[model samples]
Target: MTAAPPSATDVLIVGAGIAGASLAAALAPWRRVMLIEAEDVPGYHATGRSAAFWHETYGGARVQPLSMASFDTLACPAPEFSERGFLFPRTALTIGHRSEAGAVDGFTAQFQARGVEVVRMGAADVAAKIPGVRAEWSEAAFEAACSDIDVGALHAAYLRAAKRAGAHVATGTPLQSARRMGDGWDVQVGGQAIRAALIVNAAGAWADRVAAACGVAPVGIQPYRRTVIQLRLGVPVPAQLPLVIHIGGEFYFKGESEGRVWLSPHDETAVDPHDAAPEEIDVAVAIDRLQTVVDWPIAAVERKWAGLRSFAPDRIPVFGADRHESGFIWCAGQGGVGIQTAPAIAALLSAQLGATLPGGAIGAVDPMPFAPSRFA
Candidate 1:
């Protein structure tokens, strides 16, 4: 026998990736949160396609604080659901040629000020860090604190914790409609009507569409495509080679375990909401950049794919409910920092729902910076 579906919930979340699941787990303790995923399985998009690197100094200005706020949860993952260490040993090295020397110096100083172990390394030092690199091609570089994230394990940890907290997670559930109903909103998904006191838009690339569907102002969320290629290196590089990035941000590569390497051209091409495919031109660019710095032979590309990273106009995540609307919350526009900053964003949303903190969990940050009103 099927249990009768409730007409309402305290919170209705769209998308079951890191953002939605983490938000659900945080609010389930105080609210009846129902999470919906369009796919049969969760994390079908960017969350699944991530390169899985976790560098505290990598996010932009607005994202840095949130990333720092989430360190506690990720570093010390909940024992029951997530036991694997949050990160593996891998440093970050931003490499630069003569033309990019100034930018390299600026980056080094900025990271050093943030308590990161950042220091300018010459060609020889860079070679010491990563063997087989062409010294003449590399003008300057800096190695700092960075690591690889356990993307799958961390996402699952949040999902399990959310489920155990009594939150409802519905995969293969597509939200068909949303409308205002008295003090809350009514949403229909999977042929079942659910009333939710608050509707959190955590739908990643589809966030703007979801907002427009619910009569909330659109936040101009643009999804950009980023491609990554994996290859097996013939030469044995450092066991913990830092993620080497082109100083101008044109390309980057990370040494994976067991002599595997991941390369990206840092392509930020704008794209629509859909499963993105890696373009040949972009992959070729990555290959060319990788060849320029290292004297390594190009082996076959073992795998390649692309993901949609949604960013707001200002590239900051929108975290609060619409000021005019009583129950429509915005938890989208995470961009590429979604996985690393999930905890703080979830706590911010929960605070808004519980009315415990002012300006939500993002505390002290100007809400207008990420508010949908800016688009209006």
Candidate 2:
């Protein structure tokens, strides 16, 4: 006798990273949800390797509102979600030299116009806040609202909440095939076959591939590699040190525990989706750029890693159901803002899937900018 077919779920979400897990949490209350991950663990990619900071203006003007909408949840998480808390105070300073003062002015004006709390800081102010700040860094834009994020806690909270809400999670179960079956879909994962009324593509760098495998047209989602390193500095890094970023986008660094500093070259090299590793030149470039910004000595390189930040053709996130295939939804191309915007993005996605927005926190913020139809 043939084996019975796998049960059908109301929604089948691919990619068990923050996006997929959070979406599952949001939808499980209303629908039967199943979240499948390609790896043995969720967030084994970008979400796991994030630098973990919540900055309102990091993802440009189009993406700011999503970040703004997520602040409340991060700042005051639900009691059931996390008792350890997810966010802590960590200011951010974007600095530029006298020659690039115009750039700094434009950066400040751009975000300030969008209602983001930002202030212009003189070289003296910048120096006082950041020890050993170079003299050439004469102008800066200070965002006091920036904060460090406990990524592990946040990701775990979402997964736990999702499970509590009755969402089934399957790790190490990569999608093998997907095809239209009546108004729903027949999807094969590993050795099991399941059916779902809808599918959410939150596969990060493999978003396009997942779409194509399902016979859905690709949305031009491309993955790019970014490298980050941790250093043990000769000078003690203050516990309260603000995240320092260069206006020119060359590098950024902030202090971690035990005098260790986390540094990134701010590099965006185009690459295919896979396990990313740091390049020696990228690490060297990060050190060189850090030296130009501060006079602090780097005692030793402690750790280094890289992760893929995928993007749509236009760089803004891709959401909404596909134009051609209504049952297929696009929730990929989040870039670096995925973690900061996860709560809002999931809420918006839930609304699109016929659920009410939780507490109406995303009030009046238009979701058209992130609609996948824009690409069509």
lDDT at 156, model 2: 91
Off by over 4 Å in 2: 1-6
- Per residue, candidate 2 scores C-alpha lDDT tens digits across 10-90 of 899999999999899888888889888989889998999999799999988999999999998899987877776688999
Query: Tens digits of per-residue lDDT for model 1 on 1-376?
Result: 1243367788899999989998888888888988889887898988999987766666665677777667666767557757666877678888887667788888877867766667887777777777788866455546555778888888888888888988888888878889997888888787888888788899999998988888877778899999999977777765577888777778888887667789999899998899899999998888998888888886679999999999988888888867677578888898878988887778777876883543333464344565655655
The parts of candidate 1 lying over 4 Å away from their true place are 1-5, 137-143, 355-376
User: What residue pairs clash in candidate 2, if any at all?
Assistant: none
Q: Which ten residues in a row have the lowest lDDT in candidate 1?
A: 358-367
Separately for all candidates shown, the number of backbone clashes (residues 3 or more apart, or on different chains) is: 4, 0
lDDT of each: 0.79, 0.90
Q: What is the lDDT of residue 154 in candidate 2?
A: 93
RMSD of each: 2.8, 2.3
